[model samples]
Target chain A: MQSMSSSLNALWNHLSDSPLLYLTLTLIAYQIGLFLYQKSGKKPLVNPVLIAIVLLVAVLLITGTPYDRYFQGAHFLHFLLGPATVALAIPLYRQFEKVRKSALAIAISLLTGSAVSAVSSVLIAWALGGSEQSFLSLAPKSVTTPVSMGITEALGGVPSLTAVLVIITGILGASLGPTVLNIVRVKSWAARGLAIGTAAHGLGTARKLQVNEEAGAFSGLAMGLNALATAILLPIVWYWIF
Target chain B: MLFYLTIILLCQLFGEALVTFFALPVPGPVIGMALMFVGLLIKGSVPDGLSVVGESLLSHMSLLFIPAGVGIMVNAELIQREFVPISVSLVISTLLCIAVTGLLMSWLTRNKSIGGYKE
Candidate 1:
């Protein structure tokens, strides 16, 4: 019995030492999250990304594992973000005709939305006595994760903090965006999708995609456009204002 | 699938080259997306393989962000201290953002012809 217990302990230690352990754990957690999300009838409130993060955090805490260590494995998944972002052009292409028809409306609305999201976030945080770092971080909160993280780092804010802010912004936007659009009498799929994508990025795009194809396409377009606009505009705006 | 991925990586490489050459502040992937958009425009249609890969990636888009989202653990202290400001701003600003964008798009496209479509 003693020999068997010692062997099991050795096996556990060996598995824990491998980077694959964290990678496998993250994938498994996300699969569970996806299951729950589907089981819940794809409700926005049961966000798989949110659930996966919570589960991973809990696991890390329970194991007393450092985030940096876990990230070593998880970074492989993170690295895919670049290629995935480029993949967004596929949907945009599929909807190009519709996008071209609404070019003026889309461009104008995107500009206004991007500006409003950035400015309002900073102002609200500042008014509530958020530090300078918080102010800068919040400035890019509404943009997509990868772009926003780059913006935050460039602006001297904490990237990890900005990452958190971006996710929460996405969750909130995905949950409340459709209802808000209905309240504002925005009935068009293009408008609804663009609004949510502008505010929530990929998460909003995912939500929009689940509802309607046209809406999803526009949301994807808005997400990419917002990334470009925020990356270019926020830095200039920050320098000009401060 | 491999070919499609290669195209994406090439676009990203081109995007990175452009950013570095111009010293643009934009992320390479965003630039890559733009270039791919242009490529599609020139091509006039998305290839089946490209669409397949793209759709797969996008379908799992939320999962890609999990690594970063879990990064919240690193900022626990800062978040704890600034919880009110952070949460309040996130909720209010997101709502305002949605409203502003939705209203503006709906209003601008109300005439229908301006957007070149009747809907």
Candidate 2:
């Protein structure tokens, strides 16, 4: 026991000196958690992201480490989000010929979709006595992270909270999407991609790719275009409403 | 998967360095993503080795998001107070996003002029 304590003390001192060590370890730990999550089969509650979060939280608790420290290293992974978002353009570009052909219809649908999302939420929340910021966060929930975070900040909601909602929304959409699609008897690749991306955002787009290339491509288009649309529209609506 | 992860990590480091030097408002992951995307675009096709890594990473993208999601607890007070707007926005936006995307795609493909043709 005494020797273990000394070893732990040495390790702690090492991590404190080179904080990136903790970040690297945290990522490794997350990957391992993911491996275990998959190995455990398709239980909804045992979702890998959920598992990884729980594991990391426990690690933070035991090690007495601060979130800022973890974020210092983990932020690297977060950084990949931007390019990954743009990389979405690849699949989208692959489908450009088709997308270009359908430009008008796509534009109208996105416009309507954006408005409905923003307006209905505010109206409903006002009915329920929800605050303006609550309405603000919900307003950009369907868009990608960076845009949504910006909208949240602009509308006087918590950006971090928006981030959480975005993740949850993405997970729920990805996991439940296909099942629901089948139930609704929705057919066609465009329908699949549109539904996945609109409902799920980036993660949903990733999920759509798993089923087929066309679906993935369309999903990417939906996510990106919607991101562009909402980024432009959300603030305007916020100004109009406030 | 390991190689892809390493590359992702390297991008993260690069993103941080660049952001620090330039003081950009952009996040690191976003920068890393941009670098990787450029590399992939220039390459045109994902290399066989990296393809495997990307597939693995993308397959379980949810796991990568979990830690951040749980970070919600940090702002529990704000969320509790702002729950109405946030929740409403999510549901409404999701519904809108789906409806718009669907309508647009349908309209675009109405004549079957898009990429894939109807059989």
Candidate 3:
């Protein structure tokens, strides 16, 4: 009995020491989140991303695990974001014909939307007594994660802080965007998708995808275009202004 | 699956090379996406394997972001300090952006029957 208990302790320690433990935990937690999200009628309010983060944070805190350690395992999932981003071209490709017909409209709206998203956030942060670092970081808050992080780093912002802001921005956009569109009488899926993607990036795109494929395709297009535009324009505009 | 993964990775590899070579400020993945888009345009259609793989990735797209989102804990102090500004700007600007974009897009395309939406 004593030997069996010791062996059990040894097994536990061995498993805990492996990076795969955290990775498996993360995937399991996400599955639970996804299940909860579906059970809750897949409402935006019960976002799987938000739930998973909360659960993981709670677990990490309870177990006294460092964020860096958790990240060591989680980074594997993070690395896939690049290829997933590249994969977005598929939906955009499928929607090219629709995009071509309204190219001018899409361009005009995207330009205006991107400008408003960056400018309003920066202005608000400045008004609220945020520091210079905050201004730089908040400027790219609306772009998707990887692109936003890159832009924030280039613009002399805190990329880590920007990552947080970007996720919050995405969650906010996903939750509130549709209601705002409804209030404004914006009924078309294309317009709705464009607004969500431009404002919320990938999270918003994911939300739009749940609604319909057409909306998803447009959201993907908006996300890609917004990433490119923000990447090019933010730096030029920042240098010119500040 | 292996073939599709290779194609995706190859595009990303090429994109990283291009960015490094040009010293571009853009993220390699964004450039990779653009390259892939252009490739599709030239090909005139998305390949079945590529779309299958792409769709699979995209279907779970939200899952990929959780790790980065969890980084919020690391910046808990910064967030606490700038809580007001961060929260307020995120909420207000996000709303304004959505309203402006949706309204403008709807208005601009109101006269046109485009993308199956008769607006």
Candidate 4:
């Protein structure tokens, strides 16, 4: 027990100095957590992302490491997010033939999705007596991170809080996505992909991949396009509403 | 790998420039994505190695959220106090989004098929 605590202390010291080291270690730990979750095979509830977050949080709590210190390392991986989003276009491009056929439908759907995501939150939060600040954070909940962070600020939400909300929203959506789709009887690859990305963002894209490559590709495309659409439109809607 | 890295960087730089020039509200990355999408559209394919790199990037996309995820610590007090409204708002908004998009696509596709003969 003493050795364990000492190692944990060493871990934090190493993490504070070079954050990337912490991220690398976190990734490995998450992989192990994932394997365990899979072996137990309860499914759905044992989502790897959720498990990783829980385990890592506990590890940090026990090791006396501050979240900010851990984040210093983890954020480098986050910086790659933009290039990763751009990379989604490859799979999307490969499926261009099918996409071309449904281009108009996709555009309209994404636009509608973006509007509903931004507006409904404000309305509901208002009805529930949520403060304007909470409304700001909630308004861009459907969008990908960078854009959501921006929209949160533009609409007077807490950007940092918005970022956290974005991750939780993504994890929840991704975890329940398949079960929900099945319940809705959605069968088309395109339909499933659109649903996940339109709602869940990157985590949904990850979930879609587990189901199939086409679903993943389409979900990635939807996630990117929706980010673009939401970023441009949310502020306009926010101003009009508020 | 190097070539794709160059393209990614170029796209980012170009995207940042467009956003700055247009005074757009969108993030540079979103603009980068749009630029990359156009590039892909023009070329009709992602360059060979670009596909591999792109795949690797997508495979671990969730890792990118960890930093932002950890940011949750920044507002524990706020979240605890207003957890109900915030949590509900996030979940409901997401569901509404999915339903709206799905229903719109379903309806639009149906309308398109019903209105005209296919090629």
Return the TM-scores of chain A for each candidate in numbered order.
0.92, 0.85, 0.91, 0.88
Of the two candidates 1 and 2, the one with more favorable TM-score, higher being better, is 1
Q: What is the C-alpha RMSD of each candidate to the true structure, in Å?
A: 2.8, 5.3, 2.4, 4.2
- Looking at model 3, residue A71 earns an lDDT score of 86
What global local distance difference test value does model 2 have? 0.65
Name the docking class for model 3.
Answer: medium
- DockQ of structure 1: 0.60
Per-residue lDDT of candidate 4, residues B88-110 (tens digit): 88778877677667666666666
Candidate lDDT scores, in order, read 0.86, 0.65, 0.86, 0.77
Per-residue lDDT tens digits for candidate 1, residues A1-242, read 99999999898789877878988988898999989988999776787878899999999998888898888878888888888878878877887777888899999999999999988888888899999999889989888887788999988998889889999899889888887887887888888889999999988887777677778889988988898899988888888877
Which candidate wins on DockQ? 3
Better of 1 and 4 by TM-score: 1
What is candidate 4's DockQ? 0.45
- Model 1 residue runs over 4 Å out of place are A1-6, B113-119
Q: Per-residue alpha-carbon lDDT of model 3 for A1-242, expressed as tens digits? A: 99999999898678777778888988888898889988998676787788889999998888777788888878888899889888878888887877888899999999899999999999998899888888888988888887888999988899998998898888888877888887898888889899999999988887777677777777878887898899899999999997
After aligning candidate 4 to the native by TM-score, how far in Å is the CA of A3 from where it should be? 15
TM-scores of all candidate predictions against the true structure: 0.93, 0.74, 0.93, 0.88
**Which residues of candidate 2, in runs, are more than 4 Å off?**
A1-7, A16-46, B1-67, B80-100, B103-119
Candidate 3 — which pairs collide? none
Residue A131's lDDT within candidate 2 is 70
Which residue runs of candidate 4 sit more than 4 Å off their true CA positions? A1-15, A40-42, B110-119
